[model samples]
Target: MIEAGKKIILFDGVCNLCNNAINFVIKRDKNDVFRYASLQSEIGKKLIAERNIDISKIDSILLIDPKIAYYHKSTAALQISKQLSGIYPLLSVFLVVPQSLRDWVYDIIAKNRYKWFGKKESCMIPTPELKALFIDQ
Candidate 1:
């Protein structure tokens, strides 16, 4: 279960691009507002089922704000950026760009992510110091 005030990020575990993005977020998570789970993990599958998310449609990233709401694709990315340190929050301005346009671009990148960035055979294993920040690892 998610703790109060914590947001959960569910990502493609074997994706290099997704893994790099998570590392970037971890470095800027000054507020410690995030917890992570690989989409391939049991907890990730459970959360997806609980939310009734159709991963067949959107299979990249997801942001779960506990009982409040959940977000996917570009909306999820922008929302996560807004909570990070430095000027990353400014990325939220793209929210007004229209969801259709935003998702079109997201789809292009996601479709090519594996070919462009490659992938690992298995999910990333969090280091000892970072283990507490992850769930279902």
Candidate 2:
């Protein structure tokens, strides 16, 4: 189980886009604010069940703050960006655009993600070097 304090990012395990995004966040996470779990994993499923999240309706990305609560969709993305290093924090300016509009775009991309980015036969297996950053390695 993930300890208190860090954020846990739950993502579609087989998704190429999601995997790449994880790598992106890892590279920029100078403050070490995040951990990860594939949404298909036992731990990820437990988190979803504990939060009463409906997987059929929301299976993209989830940001579980562990201390606070959870966030999804564009809110999760923007919140994660706000904690990153360099110019990423500036992307929070998009928060002023209105959530409905922002999520609409996010939804479109999420809906077509597999088609556009392809998928692995199974969930990604983190390299040995990155294992500590994952919840269920």
Candidate 3:
């Protein structure tokens, strides 16, 4: 697991889109500002319970910044975009568009994700080079 103060991304490991999104963040996060965990893992479950988060209502991305706070769905995506390098950082502008509208779009994509992107039978195995970046359970 990451140190207490570091930011961590909790995601759906079996979802292809979610997996690709994690890779996208990994590539743009030049500062290495984030760590990752699959929402299905023991650590992910423990974090949810500790935070008093209702897993049944949240199936999208979650960004946890320890004592600072956490963000879900569109908010999480925008918060992460702000930390990325290059044009990726520009995506943060979408935050001004009103959360309900943005999340409506996000929800559409999320709801259809498995049918559209396919799923892995098991969790992803990070490559040896990027192994250290993940928080193993």
- On lDDT, the leading prediction is 1
Q: Which digits, one per residue and each the tens of the lDDT, describe model 2 over residues 1-137?
A: 67668999999999999999999999999999999999999999999999999988777899999778899999999999998999999999999999999999999999999999999999999999999999977
Using TM-score as the measure, the top candidate is 1
Q: Where is model 2 more than 4 Å wrong at Cα?
A: none
**Error in Å for residue 44 of model 3:** 0.6
| Model 2 error, position 76 (Å) | 0.5
For model 2, what is the C-alpha lDDT against the true structure? 0.93
Steric clash pairs (candidate 1): none
Q: Clashes in model 2: which pairs?
A: none
TM values, all candidates:
0.97, 0.96, 0.95
List, in order, the clash count of every candidate structure. 0, 0, 0
Write down the RMSD of all candidates, one decimal each. 0.9, 0.9, 1.1
Clashes counted in candidate 3 amount to 0
Better of 1 and 3 by TM-score: 1
Candidate 3, lDDT over the whole model: 0.89
* Tens digits of lDDT, candidate 3, 1-137: 57766799999989999999999999998998999999998888888888999988789689998867789999899999999999977889899999999999999999999999999999899999888878864
Regions of model 3 farther than 4 Å from truth: none
